[model samples]
Target chain A: MLLLQSALVQSALVQAALGALPAARPTWNLALPGQLLGALGPDLLLAGGAVLLLLVAVARPESDRHQRAVGWASLGLVGLTIVAVVAYASRGALATEGPIAVDTFRWAVDIVVLIGTGCTIALSMESNPLDGILTAESHVLVLFSAAGMLLLAAARDLILVFLGIELMSVAVYILSGLDRRSERSAEAALKYFLLGAFSTGFLLYGIALVYGATGSTNLATIGEHVARYSLMYNPMLVAGVALLLIGFSFKVAAVPFHMWAPDVYEGAPTPITAFMAAAVKVAAFAAFLRIWLDAFPTVAYQWHNAIWLLAVLTMLVGNVVALRQRNLKRMLAYSSIAHAGYLLVTVVVANSLGASAFLFYLVAYTLATMGAFAVVIALGEPGERNQEIADYAGLWTVEPWLAAAMAVFMMALLGFPIAGGMGFFAKWYVIDAAIHAPHPQTVLAVILVLASVISCGYYLGVVLTMFMKPRPANAPAVRPVPTGTFLVIYLSAFTLLLFGVLPNGFVQLAHDSVPISMVGAPARAPVASAASR
Target chain B: MYPLFYSFCFYLFGLIAIASALAFVTRRSPVAAALWLVNVLFCLAALYVMLDAPFIAAVQVLVYAGAIMVVFLFVVMLLNLGLPGELADARGLLAKILAGLAGIVLLAKIMSSRTAVPIESLMLRPDSLATVARIQGAVAPVAQPLFTEYLIAFEVTSILLLVAAVGAVLIGRRRAAAVEGVGAG
Candidate 1:
């Protein structure tokens, strides 16, 4: 009766009274859970091996000779992490309230990021000699950064997400400026570092405010609390959520926060650019999608319009600006920005359907974008010269296989019905998801189509430049494609084409990969009641 | 009488913190600016103490005022940027206007929210500081969960540190490479 009467007292007083109780202490689980370790196994292996790789570099003499070997080692690390990911994912999703999420969504994104990293490594090994950017540790930095991406993919707690973002961004800042002789590279690094730090500040502040509002850092707990309290209109939570979205927008290069992408992409080595464009975007979107779709779904109605405006503006501005770029890297940068816009559409849909569509599109986008960059690496010469659209003219005559491969990637990007192979299916699923959303983003669906149509102006421009225009007399001779770069381009084109033709199996896998948090009434009944106890 | 004294201390620290922050930013000499920033940090720590978050207050004094201020002073000395004269400020009119507007908006929001909102009815426990520092001692409450529930974050933070270290190495290695290039040429 006294305990019952205590419940009616002030909560702060109740908390203090409970703290004073001499009941058997609820023992803290200091021993890490087996499921937690299994879930984290891939990230641990990648990070631990990256440290070993750095140590190896520290021991060895600084020489260009070690670069290719280090690059291969990094590729091997990615391959191993992928194996671990698949092994764990096969056991099915682990329902975790821990900092790390172990589910199909994380496994899927991990695979995509690893594939992108592998291609980047292979391309880097091939091209670093030509560019005189043969820092042996650059490959190890890529490995560390990919490990960070894996962490980002799995992070369920806001603190883990912050650590992941920092680990990812710092390695990339160094990688961007690896070609120390180039002033452009220095400018790219400085700009990226400054802007990245700024966005991180926003993210941390958002996390702090959200923690303040919800009294929890775990995404599931936050979601549960938000729903139970009907805190969708809470000013502090609203501002925090907005800032978090803005931070993710900057990372994914959505229209307003995309100023750094073009310069960073153009100035970084092409392979690193591909990693940034493909893997970085994939990881950031994975966390963003999971965080919002899981933790902030209760407030989806509030944020839908903001994301809608972002998607609309991102799509319009990205394509319109991409249309005018003559430089191929800058063009690809804007194209990636445009792709970021399309991805934001999946976010706007805000359901398991959107999540599945996002997974499917990421796979398609990763393959084509990395392949196109590999082609760019093959075409461009030392000092990153001869990369203009005009330089790509009559590429068909010089290297028909390379030109054909480049065209496949370009058409894939454009989402042409037959020629694009997998890209059309990817776009089809996204539009389907948008139309079928709880809010039915019919207008956004239409905007997505119009944006895709605008994108054709640039994607097809590259293909036409390669096939239709006459080769300039002063066009730099296409370099002999290295074995690693060739392998990446060939495999990417082949896989994308195959999937494009028969996407049913892949689509099923993607449909299954939606984060488990979105599958039902997330986290069961009201958590506020549980918190009160 | 006690409540009045407590609030008086709060206001004293708060006003001083704001004034020192302004001074920190406006000072022409970099060393003077850095010292003023240290003063601002000390005021913040004092306010934190009044708020009953002594751990945070200690951290504020030790990390920000002690360690970080030293680093700032070192940088100011190394760059010889302490000279007040000829250090052209980049403060434009637009920037000044924006800053003033931002300060006014912040103040207005604080004042209005305090008056209008029934903040106590929000169900947020007003005394979270109790749970923050109970347990076996002052440090145990924080250290316990940090090593137990938040252990994974702690482990991941090490990777962040490693990445930072690798970045510093890359920068150093690049400088070496550049010098070698110059010598060879």
Candidate 2:
């Protein structure tokens, strides 16, 4: 009789617990959302492809042939992803709000990141064997990192953003140290890992503090709360925003936080360096814009001064320091920092026009930078030797085509009008956006022009060195450029020139790619204007 | 009345945890510091048990307080570190002052925030969590959220972990091979 009573009480407890569980949770539901594919198709495809490639890598031992095959396969996968992104982008954004984005902006970033990934794979395929890195796993790491980048482009919530950052960072960290024989590569990896982890800590703490202040991590929801409550000056929110700005500064390699870029870029393999400078920068900037525009529009005023200061410091420091770098790789690293400053100008605008301008500038920047890195690989010998600025002193004498192509890349980076081609229009639109902002950043526009002039000291220095200086008496013979790398360089230069002459269509596409939800977020206007975001 | 006892135990354990953490930092010997860390972890586990999360408490004791602490002790012994005076510590006056200032400021902020921003309305309200915990047992409280609304993040975390593990193995093996080659030569 006592045993039966105990059993009855246990059953009663179980039923009571089950009954209260539903009432205790008022807002949350366990049912899956209605739609998923239109937003997440490309990311899922990329992840699937990467996992399969990783398995393939596990099956094969490290070999030059295996590496090449993996490289080609990675490029093909990136191509398919680009096709999916373009198709879905035309279909418009998903109607429902979720953790991941599926807008034209996200798709545009996807295409740009994939372009960089494809080129990096081609370049690495040519250079890896020469460097004696036979691991097919390196290609798999690149694919994994690219998938992470795609996720970053689509992240709509803070937690997703953190995961995306980690996924991208872990893969890139290994890729940087793939040439393990070199002590410099190991040092680069360790420094990058330690410092990157530290920055991630700052990012997480900021997210936590923001969550504490407003009780939401969803960007759209946070924006609504901030607008409705007027939490702009709330001390906690301000501190969270400040920390977030600092964290992103580290990620994007802005001045005062870019101590790692030069050493790591120089020590890393050239292909990985290009990936860092192009795709990594693009992804970080895209996420930065997304978070700032979508989540913190009410408190956006808090960051304008801070961003303006960073932009000025980054531009001045990056260009002035680049003039002193003799190593081509380090110089390009610092140049990327300067470009980061230019990108920050667009963030300052924080309007539809600015995002549109950012898309165009980023595309042009990627093309020019990738073409330049390809040329760097073509000219560099094995073991990363002979990459000094003077090494290409008389490239026009032995290899006129390579020298001319190099000049085109340099001029484009310098933003020279006709010579720079697409680069000129890219810079013009950024300045146009800055000046036409609700409150004009006229001083910033002028500073940008001055920084470009300062950058000419190095960009033109490369061009003049190639055209005017004589080749050394015992210079090494020019290498035969790989067909894949040659194609990358040719396409980039051709597109830059072609678009420089006629930029109407590209401009329209850039304009169209601006996030529709962010269209009303001009300066001094509350982003609450975009309903149903 | 039972809930009051739970809060009393929480405060007691929290105080012990804080004191031990301070001692852990200040301890001269590495082993002593690690032992203090174990003490703190135990207090945390006991506090977890008071909340009726015996599974979490057991796991915390097993994984962190026991296993990870043993590793720490092993590393401390293996390194054979020197005297306490030689061990790295915050020696500079400026650093000391700055650290103290930061701590004081943080304390001030928390104290001031007590009235202005109570903890209840903030992101991690304990009331709702307690009810959920009663229904879900020890791990379910965490796993419920992880597998449900944040399912994608949870799945992607596995990919991140796999990538990290593979990278470590690949890098470690290459290093070992190079060292072996050197030894053979």
Candidate 3:
């Protein structure tokens, strides 16, 4: 009896010990927001939209009948999210404690990304290869990629940046090869995957080096350490910064590292290419600007010239190579690279105006590219790739609306004035910032203007081919208008022109949306506290 | 001596990796390229071990070398690419020129990069066995935070992967059926 009692006591003690040990940390409760209402607002909405899409795909697996409905609903949801993001921005209610800041800066990019995603979804619904892949995956990947882009634009740490880049890239790599029937598509996916993995290696190693030099992956902490200790000359840190630049430049399709751009753009579904050229480019450049501006502003003297030289090479190479391209998508791919050069000029200035210019240019770029892709999707027939310049000859005759939309895209891309649209203002802002920079950034500005001039060659080539070139005697005529694709084309064109003409309102919002709370808070407060002093 | 050891190990692995990477790209035989890529991955694993990221090093070898490379080999063989003419057609002139240019540029960049300083001095409280242990303990919380903060994202990623897997299977199955029909016809 006594032995049994002792055993019971021992068992009780063991139970107590087990209970005291931290419960295997719950996965779903770690960093969830406190207030239930705010907790799942945006995330829940995004999830709900995804679930609805999944349900739609499952309900009608083989039929393409209600595809137009899916496109319309997706666009409406995306538009709603843009409004929600704007509301969040205005209320200043985006709360977070991690390396990602959820603020107005993020909101602006989110709006642009969502719009780009909406256009891609619309195009995908119309005339992709549709190789037994669910439309849900397409729309879901677009949403997820946009979310990742938002996170990337708001990242304040190396870890967050890497995570965001991987998230966006993995989805895109898969999206590029969606139409597995096409050898070109598969080849494009393989090339992008290999190159992306290679660039990731550089980014990861650079992060390790940066962490080693500063003993932190947090951007603000690194900046503070570098400022106080003057370790800009540290070889490891310098190498890390340079490698990081290369990795991000690759993501943005900058020169030299942009080898994958033309092939991938030509090979992928037209909409995905448009999303990549517009939204993904914006997100990458935003993150790139934020990282450098926050962590390496003091070390600008060291790496400034490297970036300048890269900007010059990127502009020259992108524009010159584009002039020789016969493929429309490949030409746009190079044109996007040239735009990256213009954005890099803003980074060269490394100031508030530079930040504003990036945001403004993103709107114009997104609208124009999405509009262009929409037109391409609308005009293209099955098995008849509209990528070749000759394929678009006399488009003005059959599809005058599409030809007009394409003209808008080409003119905006060339940065032509007033009638050409707000793209001119976007270019002017970037140039002005570069010229007025505290540093010697005017050189980048000059190169940027020259590059824009070079861009006119290909842009006009497309316009001339569509308008002036006569049609073949017995070319296949356009069939009845497809409802879904026509919607995408008209909407994209409307947005492009609307923003171009009255860009001031959007430009102001972007300027005010800068994520200054983290880095510039101290500078903003007029009176320094005793602690600060 | 410790710094020299680190430098030597980094260079040794780096050279093996670079050579294997070149082999992977240049080899005409897809099977041979896959093997060389495995070698490159193995070298990278060793370098990770020397850098004190033993867990990551293990994951790299296990996931990349073991799983990914095996899948790559399967796909290459399944495609039945034994035609001599087919193999020869793969290496175009443009590819050769681009590869050469890329290789030279990469080599120049690597050579020009300044030597990185050793990191021991900057380690918070000077890294020790105890510090590593502490970090390992903290990893649970770090992981916890990631899950909580990104629960939707994590779940979505799982779903995405599942969909992709099923999609790939569906595509392969459909293609197989179409081939059967053609053969019967």
Candidate 4:
């Protein structure tokens, strides 16, 4: 009887030890609003600026001076936000424990977006009422859109990605139609809204399917599930990924889904066009890269072929269609589509070097595209005339400096001689990345080179018209470049050239900004579980 | 004891939903069509309730039938569309045939997929009376995840609504300006 009692006592002790195992499970701590604000500093700043601009508009109704003040204030806010992002990056604080991530990648993308927005504001500073009625609301819309871009770049959750896309898209749709007097602007707005809403449906459906398949919407949790389960062949996951690819393809204006680009790009205000082309592309591509690299890295082989086909088709269709375009804005729109193809190739490579190349190419492309559009803005009168290639005839003689800026932009866009501009280096880096990828994509690299050569047909067409073609008798004389536009053109051109000649420093920055540990890798497990929760 | 009654209610709601949806699409007048849509929504809500999701059923009635139907009525009344004949289908016969074919194909695909995946196996819990009692309360399970894991999404939805409101005002103000300018001229 004594022995049996002792055995029971030992059994109780073993049961107590086994019950303590679950105490090791990590418990999540809720982030405070103050901490969230610190992590999302740039987004909050831009949002606050937007609200302030709206209040300013309401208080001082329609005064042009007040509007200009609002514009400058918006510019200052964007500039300050860039500084904040850089500061946040320098602090090396990883506050990405919540839905948003404030890592080096986010900071670099934020800087790109903010700089593009600032340049756009400068380009729009001398707003012609006839071209588009620039209200304080325009600047406010831009600020809100920039906030959305920041959120998108930093989004670590699928829900945040959807919200960020919506916020950015809605603001842009309104901005696209801000020129109330232009029927084309209204049409652009309507078409973009309809198609954009359709694409958002696909995106939401994809998110729903992904959540259903993985039982989680948190990207890290999804990645963990994928890694643990080897869910590559799940039909629901495959469908979700396809829908997501389609949705992003529409946003980036990849061919077969790019029906809205040329019209929307041409009909929107010139500065807004530049802003959309640069900032929107950057934001969308950033989200695309993050989502594919983080959540779906385990299934890379499954989706890589689809992306490959998209890249090829986008490059071919964009350049070929652009060759037939006579309007300069439409041509640039097609060129932008072609560039999207190149960017998509880098995404397919899906390596740290590819990420760095993507960033570098984005910088080069943003500068060149914005600079080119600045020239367009400078030449355009109140009614948005002088958009034809013929309109740019003998531009070299009329405005030598503006013509020279346009030439530099064209050469950069063409990816000419290695010494010609940054675009060449950007292309080279992307090709190098493709070559060095785990599964080298030599075919894609060849297609990229061939497509670049084809693109020269249109980009050089603009250059040739500017320098060689004589002024048509009916062509309007070039308007004197505004100081704001002149500043934008020279700054972007100078940066383009400097980065081209000495790309090492910027290349290092790009390399350092790559979120290598975040992509594909599981997040760190929580250290200490809540004691006896 | 409950199986026969449950299937009866399920089929009743499902048939009503399908029939009302067809009627909603085929109606001549916008107001009549909207009323039919409300009926369809109510039927779907009933179906949801029968499927052990009372919260979703309530939302379906409140959001789809009440709120959305009101908006539809408002728009139809605002436009005062002239006649059913004027709004009749204008597509070619070939297009109509193609659309019908596509619809049939989609229906077949859905049916096949549904058959391939047995609904009994898809259930998270055994379909017993006790399990039903345990699982029927839908709000708490959904509310927990929505408030915790998806709190950011919920907040962002509010922002999206705000953006939509602002965009509407901007576009509406522009239209008003254009109309005023035309009136003055």
| Number of the predicted model whose TM-score against the real structure is largest | 2
lDDT of 2 by residue, A457-476 (tens): 99999998999999999788
lDDT of 2: 0.84
Candidate by candidate, in order, the iRMS in Å equals 0.9, 0.8, 4.2, 1.0
Model-by-model DockQ, in order: 0.63, 0.60, 0.10, 0.60
Better of 1 and 4 by TM-score: 1
**How much is the lDDT of residue B15 in candidate 2?**
98
lDDT of 3 by residue, A1-533 (tens): 77445544643442232212232321222134554235235544654675576567546644455555665677777777766665555455444334555555666677777778877887787766334333445665676676667667667778767877877787788778776456787788778888888898889898999899999887777888998988899999999988898898889888878999889988887788888898888888888888887788788778887888878888999999999998778888888898888888877877766777777788888888887777776666664265578888898988888888889878877888764576776787777667766775666777888888888899988999999999777666766656766776676666556556655445555555565443233222101111253
lDDT of 1 by residue, A1-533 (tens): 66334333432332232112223322222246665676678899999999999887667776677887787888888889887877666555455457777667888899899999999889988888787877788899999899889989988889888888888889999889887768898888878987998899899999999999999988998999999998889999999998998899999999899999999999988888999999999999999998997799889888888999999999899999999999989999999998999999999987777888898899999999999999989888889888898889999998999999999999888887767888988888888888877778899999999999999999999999889999888876777888999999999988778777656556666766767686443321111322343
* TM-scores for candidates 1 onward, in order: 0.84, 0.85, 0.75, 0.84
lDDT tens digits, residues B1-185, model 3? 38998898899999999999999887877888889999999999999778667666888999999999887877677678633345767788998899899989998877766575547776657365436545775355446745875544455466456545644654455466557767999
Per-residue CA lDDT of candidate 4, range B66-118, in tens? 98888678767756853575456654578868988998999999988985856
**Residue by residue across B141-177, what tens digits does model 2's lDDT show?**
7777778778888888998998999899889878877
For residues A1-533, write the lDDT of model 4, one tens digit per residue: 76445444543432232212232333222377566657777777777767777777667765567778888888888888877776666665555356777566788788888889898887776753446485667787788888889889989889899999999999999888888778888888878887898899889999999998898877777887988998888999889888999999999999899999999999888888898899999999999998887788898778889999999999899999999999888899999999999999988998777887888889999999999999988887777788888889888887888888898898898888553478888888888788878899999999999999999898888889999999788787777777778888998887787667655556656665665345334321111111111
After superposition, candidate 4 runs with Cα above 4 Å error: A1-34, A95-97, A418-420, A516-533, B1-26, B43-54, B66-147
Q: What CA root-mean-square deviation does each model show from the true structure?
A: 12.5, 13.6, 15.2, 13.6
DockQ of candidate model 2:
0.60
Backbone clashes in model 1, listed as residue pairs: A421-A500, A422-A500
Chain B TM-score, structure 1: 0.66
